[model samples]
Target: MLKRRLLTAALLIILIVLEILYLNSTTLAVIFAIVVALSAWEWAGLSGYLARAQRIGYVAIVLFLLILVYSAHSFWPTAITVFLLSAAVLWWLIAAYWVLRYQQQCDLLPNSSPLRAWLGGVVLIPSWLAVYQLHQQYGEYWVLFLFVLIWGADTGAYAAGRLWGRHKLASHVSPGKTWEGFAGALLVGALFAGGAAYFWLDESEALYQIGFVLLSLATVVVSVLGDLLESLFKRKAGVKDSGQILPGHGGMLDRIDSLTSAAPFFLAGLLLMGSLS
Candidate 1:
């Protein structure tokens, strides 16, 4: 299992690197849109859409929304983007609360309900917007930074959890996660952020290092939230993995779950920093 996971992860990392470095903004946008659409298809399954047509319809809606956003981006006011991003962050907070307070109660939502289908939009859209906007404004380096932080935290958590995990982080939502794993993620996040800021980032100062740490910590938190929320959906839907697309990764949604939360939060922070600076 671990070997398959590692191999899949390595291949994904290589593909992501190539995409970030070589793909132009327009090309990347199209590629990411496809990804969002595919994730929506998987999310539909987790949302209890058993029929193939319904899942494909959900993907079509997601694609339409992506196109709408892309077409109207020029008209989308700065205030609106920030507000939407803020809303995305708040949604994660609510999800975290659901994980903590109403772990079982929240699962009572009907499996066939439309809410989960809409939720795919709520999760996928902002992430795509954030990725495209970051790539447009800050270049692939900044976009890569987002991916790296999430990947680093995820890798760290898995390693630490396997080796030294004891206390549960949120056993109701995800039994495998642990507080020790969370700590390891933070530690790894900090190290990766500090190094990336100092080495790869254009501006590397003490203040930047501090900012990166804070940003990274927040990213790690939200990334975990994303993972738990998906677990919640899967648990509610009575499924184990999201899909069987990737050999060991389950699905694209499973792979990018952390990014779904991290992207918006990270972009919001970056936009705020840009406005201030």
Candidate 2:
């Protein structure tokens, strides 16, 4: 299982790198939209929309919103984009609270609830927009940097959890995670961010370098929240894996859950630092 998982991860990394290196921003947007649509389909199932039609309807709604946002965003001002990204960051903060306070209580938001549907939108659309905006405005390198931080953090967490993990980070939400793993993730992510800032960012200022590392670490922390939020949903839904789409990875949703939360927060950080202007 570990071998398969590693192989799958390697292949995904290669493909994603190629996409970032070769594809135009518009093409990347389309690809990201497709991914979001797939994730929404899986989320629909987790939300108790089991029928084929129900899932398709959910995907349709998500796609429509994506289109609407993409179209309307072109005419909107920069502040609007920042506002939307900020809203996504706020949503994830609330999601962090939900993950922390989650208990096996009665399903407050039942399956097929409109609230769940809206939650899916909130969880997905801003991520797509943030990623697309980053790739289009900043360049593919920034997107690649974001991916490196997330992937590095995940790899660090997994390795550390397996080797030295003792205390559970959130046993109720995800049994495999540990505080040791979380620390490992922060360490790895910060190292990568510092190295990248020194070598690739072309910035000589110490303050900027420090800020970049801190931002990367913050993104890594929130990526954990993203994973926990999904685990919370899966626990409530009583499913082991989100779906069996990848050989070792559970599904598209499972693969991208961290990205879903990280993208917006990363973008917000970039904006706050006046990196994008």
Candidate 3:
């Protein structure tokens, strides 16, 4: 399992780097839309849509939404973009609330529901848009920054949880995570952002350091919530993992859960900060 995980991780990294460095914004959007479609398919299964046709239809709906969003040419803070991004932000907060009240919802809600199906869109489309927007507005480096932030958080959580995990972070939703792991994620995220600011931004201003650190911390919180939100769904659905597409990674949704939640928050925060400055 460990060897497969490492091999898969290496290949995924290569593919992602190639996509970011070589692909144009439109091409990247198309590729990411495919990923989102796959995730929607998996999400359908979790939402209790076992019929293959139903799952395929869900994917179709997601793809259509992506096409609709992609056709638009709005920059950040544009009315439409802000509306969409704000909706994603609101849904994530509601999702966080769901996690906080997991036991109640898990017990009361049906395994498959229309709400979950709609949630699949809410989880996917805006995130895809956020990534594309970042690539369009800031270019490859910012796109890479988003990846590094989320991936670094995952790495830190795993290492810290393995070495010294004790107190449970979300005992019901996911047994493997711990408060120590959460702390490790924040610490590494801060370090990651700090390094980016130092080397990439090349700005020694105290304000830049503070902004980056705070943004990193906020993103860490949302990213963690994203993981927990998926775990909550899987737990309620009574599945071990989201799917079995990747050898060790479970599925695309499993791999991109953190990104699904982090992208909107990260981009929105950056936009707000950019306006402030």
Top candidate (lDDT):
2
CA lDDT of each prediction against the hidden true structure = 0.85, 0.88, 0.87
Number of clashing residue pairs, candidate 1? 0
Q: Which ten residues in a row have the lowest lDDT in candidate 1?
A: 102-111
List the lowest-lDDT window of 10 residues for candidate 2.
103-112
lDDT of 2: 0.88
lDDT per residue (tens digit) for residues 138-249 in model 1:
8998888889888889989999999999998887889999999999999999998878777766566677667767987888899989998888888887888888888878
Report the CA-based lDDT of candidate 1 relative to the real structure. Answer: 0.85
- Looking at model 1, the pairs that clash are none
RMSD of each: 1.9, 2.0, 1.9
Please list the residue runs of candidate 3 whose C-alpha ends up more than 4 Å from where it truly belongs after superposition: 74-77, 103-112
Off by over 4 Å in 2: 77-79, 103-112, 275-277
TM-score for candidate 1: 0.94
- How many clashing pairs does model 2 include? 0
By TM-score, the candidates rank as 3, 2, 1
What TM-score, computed on C-alpha atoms, does each candidate reach?
0.94, 0.94, 0.95
